[model samples]
Target: MKTRIQELRKQHKLSQEELALAVGVTRQTITSLEVEKYTASLVLAYKIAKYFDLTIEDVFDFSELEEI
Candidate 1:
């Protein structure tokens, strides 16, 4: 999934480690998410969106992917 994570993180002046710590993930996980190398779990996505005061759809773009 395409996400606005990197952009939002930068805008908020947050490092990947900080974001990961806030959301209870490893730095590598945040790195993976930022680079689109890994997809986040539903719970992780929700946590991230909530931390940013955004809905999941605002953080993750699912327009191109088929729905389950």
Candidate 2:
């Protein structure tokens, strides 16, 4: 899955560790998400979206999954 996480982080001037800390995950998990190496669980996804003050759909792209 492609994500705008890196873009958002840059715009917000947040490091991976900062974002991870805010969202209650490891920096590695944030890196994995940015690199599309991991798909977040529902709880994690919600936490991430909430941290950015966005809805799940705003933070995550479900279009690709829909195509399948």
Candidate 3:
């Protein structure tokens, strides 16, 4: 999945470690999310989205999945 996490983090001046701490995940998990190496659980997605004051749709791209 494609996500705006990196962009949002940069815009918010949050490092991966900081974001991970805020969202209760590991820095490596943030890195994985940014790189698309792993998909987030619904809870994690919700936490991440909430952290940015955005809905999950705003943070994550579901267009490709919508085609299915």
TM-score of each: 0.94, 0.93, 0.98
**What is the lDDT ranking, best to worst?**
3, 1, 2
Largest lDDT belongs to which candidate? 3
Model 3 agreement with the true structure over 1-68: per-residue lDDT tens digits: 99999999999999999999999999999999999999999999999999999999999999999999
TM-score between model 2 and native: 0.93
lDDT score for candidate 1 against the true structure:
0.96
Better of 1 and 3 by lDDT: 3
Give one digit per residue, the lDDT tens place, for model 2 in 1-68.
Answer: 87788988999999999999998889999999999999999999898888889898988889999988
Off by over 4 Å in 1: 66-68
lDDT, candidate 1, residue 32? 96
Ranking by TM-score: 3, 1, 2
Ten contiguous residues minimizing lDDT sum, candidate 2: 1-10
The per-model lDDT (C-alpha) reads 0.96, 0.91, 0.98
In the range 3-66, model 1's lDDT, one tens digit per residue, is 9999999999999999999999999999999899999999999999999999999999998786
Worst 10 residues of 1 by lDDT: 59-68
